[model samples]
Target: MGIFDVRKIDCHAHVLDPLRFPYAQGAAYRPSGQEIGTTDQFVEVLQCYGTEHVLLVQPNSGYGPDNSCMLDAIRRYPGIFKGVAIASLDADLSHLRDLRDQGIVGIALNPTFYGNDFYADSPALMEKLAELDMFVQIQVQHDQLLMFKPWIERIAVRVLIDHCGRPTPEQGLAQPGFSALLDLAETGRVHVKLSGYAKFAKTPYPFRDTLPFVRALVEAFGLDHCMWASDWPYLRAADRQDYGPLLKLLDTLFPDPADRDILLWQTPKRLFGFGA
Candidate 1:
């Protein structure tokens, strides 16, 4: 069977359906009519690419902490989906425990939209997450990575940096921010998602310009610490990007079958607790 035929899990994707689960009043942005805005539509797209499992991230479009849509999808799909939710910084332990029971394995922190202080102020909540053995998924601009170093050092929960830390080609690998991310990986508790290449890619398609940074991450973190993802629906490039090409890029980048297997299957299976 081809690599694409393997039971791969997309470690990051968003599910949005404004019709049934309307966007929050204070949402950051609303999904356009053209976007794939429902769980069934999102699943159909994943099916077209041969993906069976997905990690559904609560979209910023639902600005508030309500994750009804994401939780419902996990309930509907059972083993086929897991989720990362966005909760209020002041959310009590009871709310968190309830989220855990609902199959949420992680909490997402996006400093870019919510401001850096949200995460900095939530150490207690972070501790609760660690106690629950849940992961903390962070999305921050590259330059802001250094500011987050202290949190990384103190938090005991597993950290999953989104979009390869969203570094730019102009910053290169040695920049202090990107360098800080590399340093975090050495701690062994941190994992990096090989998603959103299109966000940082200075070139088209295969996004070769971003390869060096990816190679550096794999080197620093090793195969076990790396995981593959498709930021599906491609959001900005919904009409342009297809899921198949992203999977094909992995085959090209990690030519060794063993290494490719880790990126495509093994690492995500372990990190996301797939089949566990």
Candidate 2:
């Protein structure tokens, strides 16, 4: 069967345009490598794989609150892209309502990329996000769960844990990150992407080392709230990876078509509010 028939939705992807959205001048940001950080490049790759839609996540490389490139992409190709913008705790989200109306549905909380202080809650930030009904996507190391749990609980918005909480594959299934993930699942207040395993794996291609941890996440969150991603451009290793192989790997993770459908299609559709 073709990858298009895979019924896929790439839950984590980024567009890097230093010209339009310059690198953050602040110490909190880092420059994305020259390769694997283009909106058009990502679109071409996604279309090649028959991804029905994609959630354009904000990468830490372009850490500033500005989302011009991301928003422009969605505006240019509305049918193919949905967006998740990232903002710091100090950001003024007053304009989010208009952005939300324009298909910007989520904001990322990147404590690991910025600093642990970014996860600290601001009543105004929470109030603005709640008003817009946006999802707050958190990218935190597994051990740092306690740092953001209280804020997560206080927010009325939907929560998405980036990259299975960026758990280390070597941690196996019993690490604090995984445990925190399970506990969060018990509350039914969060969703985790089955993406970015490449980032956490210790070995080379064929990152089978992550199988046990990936399996445990599936068991804990089930098929409904779990989704797949390519982490495309593959960031640091963009040259070594592409969307096709990532989809192939995801198929191995889910196996059964019904479960695969949820991971690849259904769950993201629900979580990201993709239109049928």
The clash count of every prediction, one per candidate, is: 1, 0
Number of the predicted model whose TM-score against the real structure is largest? 1
Tens digit of per-residue lDDT, candidate 1, span 1-276: 576777778988887777778878866677765655578887787777778788888877553577988888999987789999998777777888888888888888888667777677767777888888888888877687787777778878888899888887887889887899999876789999988888878788888888999999999999899888888666656247777888888877888888877877788888878788
Report how far off residue 226 is in candidate 2 (Å): 0.5
Candidate 2 ranges beyond 4 A from true positions: 26-34, 91-93, 122-124
lDDT of 1: 0.82
- Candidate-wise lDDT, in order: 0.82, 0.75
TM-score of each predicted structure versus truth: 0.94, 0.89
lDDT of 2 by residue, 155-255 (tens): 66677888878777666677875777777776676888887876777776568887787788788888898888878766666337766777777656766
Q: Point to the candidate with the largest lDDT.
A: 1
lDDT of 1 at 136: 82
Name the 10 consecutive residues with the lowest summed lDDT in model 1.
232-241
- Residue 128, candidate 2: Cα error in Å is 3.9
Residue pairs clashing in model 1 are 16-37
